[model samples]
Target: MPLTKEQVIETLRQVNYPGYSRDIVSFGLIQKLDVSDEMIRVHLVVRSTDNNVAQTIKRDVEAKLKEAYPAAKHEVVSEIQEPPQFKTTASETAGKEKFLAGIKHKVAVASGKGGVGKSTVAVNLAVALVKLGKKVGLLDADIYGPSIPLMLGVDEKPLYDGKKIQTIEKYGVHLMSLGFLIDNSEAVIWRGALVHRALQQLMSDVAWPELDIILFDMPPGTGDAQLTLSQSVSLDGAVIVSTPQDVALIDAIKGVQMFRKVNVPIMGIIENMSYFVCPHCGERTDIFDHGGVAKVCAQLETELLGEVPIDARIREGGDGGKPIVAMDPESPQSKVFLEIAQKMYDKIENQ
Candidate 1:
């Protein structure tokens, strides 16, 4: 069988963009492909501050090709490049039907990698804002993993207020998510294009009432959701969340750089699970090792918005569908998120 460029490209499509469900081919990450009977060569251009991204892509490309052609020689070249500004400035959205148009402030709560409590912070922060008497809406843009509905304890589908779907209110905050629209048990098996379109509909298709601000619980990674938000909407800023560890901080730093690269102001970073305090004994333990966020903030020149300790109360509240901030605003467990929310809202307002 003769090796062909088409076959090589198709095989490469199986390689997903490092942290996302999408492929490199769809993202236009494959810069060049050369195929012949003697050898197969591929060039990939990854636009990420994380150097590991390029290596990961190159490794995946080689592995796929090698599996397909065991006897053929292969060369994978990866180019690490900085992407041009990928955001729509406030000026660009003027006179345009950009989503987030009427809101006083538009913000995205994001993390490059998941499992660092990004969505947790977003949920608590939104509740905190409402407690502070700010009209707020939360859009669960994590189409693939919509948790807003579960975390906020809203079960019913959003009722239409005429032509547009009305946001389901919970804990005094307006909330919308695909999780609310579909069966919670059913998985959202969507491609990148569908995910992109869904985000548009989530933002522009629905009727979000005029409010002080809205926070987008962005999906993890620099994929479709982030791409759609950065290119189409005018975001006031973004709040990055991470754990107090090297792996999480590395991804968190990449997230901060991505927002900065696209001209999105980083409101600050929230070190979630920053530390764990003993319930039995009054002792503090750095479960994931502390002080990493301070170093990250110093290196990135961003603010350490606040630290959220690892507490059972937070988890219990989230799982129980009554976040601590809204349930007990005066509790210490809730104050971390509240303080961060206050800082974010005040920062965006001052801007």
Candidate 2:
């Protein structure tokens, strides 16, 4: 009723690594193979930091083993074996240095809550950076609701240029979103591990042309998925987005704390929808109550980058697939984004 260790190893042996032609089990990377009635447990070692290939192998092996041995349940635990110091020769060292490649800086835009205009800020910030003559890339790592494609007005799928996936270009900014890979009508339902793999692909599988900056639109939360993300890449900094509401400010603090826990710098905080400007009277109102984020940032001894007023035009512009900053470069809302962009540049450049 239980699969023996040899059968487990042989089953894994049939699954091939995508980049490498070798089977996983024969590579001597399979360990702790155990079997019980109707259950299979195993551990796998993936040497090197090539997470993309390792994940692919893991997924394929799991799917195949479950299909071939339909009556049995299997669970595989995997770990990456760090490459030895001496094995990293001069040439290898040079190759690995190209991880971020041409990117001068990477900023992750995150929030503690959803529907707080986190993606909107991320999209506008990337556009703002491009407007300032910097080559930019906006990676929509928000695996669940990837609205970057919708915000940027690019409905076309990215071109696969032989070796790497080419990011779709729009508004002078290279764009990549999970939305580009799936049908617009479909939904992405993935657990934490799957989300991590997808994020890894977006970071490593794609060829982001020499970029001055790359903005990541991270998913909302402080869950394991977000924790795994913080551990994976070396972020230059993170900009937490929040509204003027007290609950939102609390979550924003948690976002800042998460980055601080992982040693990533908190570039600053951006207050979105801080206030509303009446279209009919041109009067400003603290719709959500103003200065909440700025006060919080001050208490934490961090910078409050800038405040984005709640303007109907900004919402309209986003829904219409043209970010407010791009649609009306001279508008008041646009000015706020521009100021935030300038301050962010100064902060990172000084570092």
Across 1-351, the per-residue lDDT of candidate 2 in tens digits comes to 445777777777888645334577656678678876588877888653456656776788789778878888889777776423222245644643545667888888999889799999998888888889889999998888899988888888888978899988888889999999988888888987888788878878899888889998999987765765566665789999999877787678678777776667889899999888788898889988788786677655688998898877888878878998888888888888988998898888898
Who wins the lDDT comparison? 1
In model 1, the clashing pairs are: none
Deviation (Å) of 25 in candidate 2: 54
Candidate 1 TM-score, C-alpha based? 0.75
TM-score of 2: 0.71
RMSD of each: 8.5, 16.5
lDDT of 1 by residue, 1-351 (tens): 777788888888899875555688977888888889889888888866567767888888888988988889999999987645665556767623467677777899999799998888889999999989999999999998999888898888888767888888888888989997888789888877898889988878788888898999999887778877877777889988888777777688779888887788888888899899998996999998898887667656678999999999898888889899988999988887788888888898788
Deviation in Å, model 1, residue 186 alpha carbon: 1.9
Give candidate 1 misplaced runs (Cα > 4 Å).
Answer: 1-92, 95-97
lDDT agreement of model 2 with the native: 0.80
**How do all models score by TM-score?**
0.75, 0.71
